[model samples]
Target: MTEEGDQEEQTILTWARNYAKKHHWVLNPDEKKLGIVIRGLARNKQKYGEQYCPCRLRSGDKEKDAAIICPCIYHEEEVEKDGSCHCRLYFRKDALSE
Candidate 1:
């Protein structure tokens, strides 16, 4: 990857880490997979003008789709019920042990 791409990835990772911390959540420990999802978020931000979750299908309605933006409305519920968000990016630390 180019230096620029590397830097962007780092930035995204940092933002994700901090965001997860704020919510008392943890990011998946698998760095390789996390990096891929971070890149997807960056791409979505560039393409759609918002960081929509890459794992989700866009309905093309900006208002409806807004809910799927990073730290989507479903994340809390998903993490609580499924251990991780649908994309398996952010996960509850307790879930890792189970």
Candidate 2:
């Protein structure tokens, strides 16, 4: 949500650089939006589900390591991140129950 020349944009870059340090994953190509983005292949199911994991290193919390608080990332507070246009973000219980 920052304009090109705005200082807030610069601040966002600082945040982005920190996000990049999280892992070795490179920025994905479909990434034309504002922040850092990563991409990978994922399976889908009819019912969409989302969750936020502890990997998101928000400012100030002692447990820095990743935790399995939630299984999927939602786009609102989170949303199912896009892998490719063809893939839907969900898991079928019958298929997932394995």
The top-ranked prediction according to TM-score is 1
Instruction: State how far residue 6 of model 2 sits from its true place (Å).
Output: 1.2
Candidate 1 to truth, TM: 0.89
Instruction: Report RMSD (Å) for each prediction in the order shown.
Output: 1.5, 13.9
Candidate 1 lDDT tens digits, 19-95: 88998889989988888899888778767878889899999999999999987999999999999999899999899
Q: Which ten residues in a row have the lowest lDDT in candidate 2?
A: 38-47
lDDT of 2 at 18: 59
Candidate No. with top lDDT: 1
lDDT of each: 0.88, 0.27
lDDT per residue for candidate 2 within 14-85, as digits (tens), equals 543454344322222233432322111110111112112323433333243223212223312222133211
Backbone steric clashes in candidate 1, count:
0
lDDT of 2: 0.27
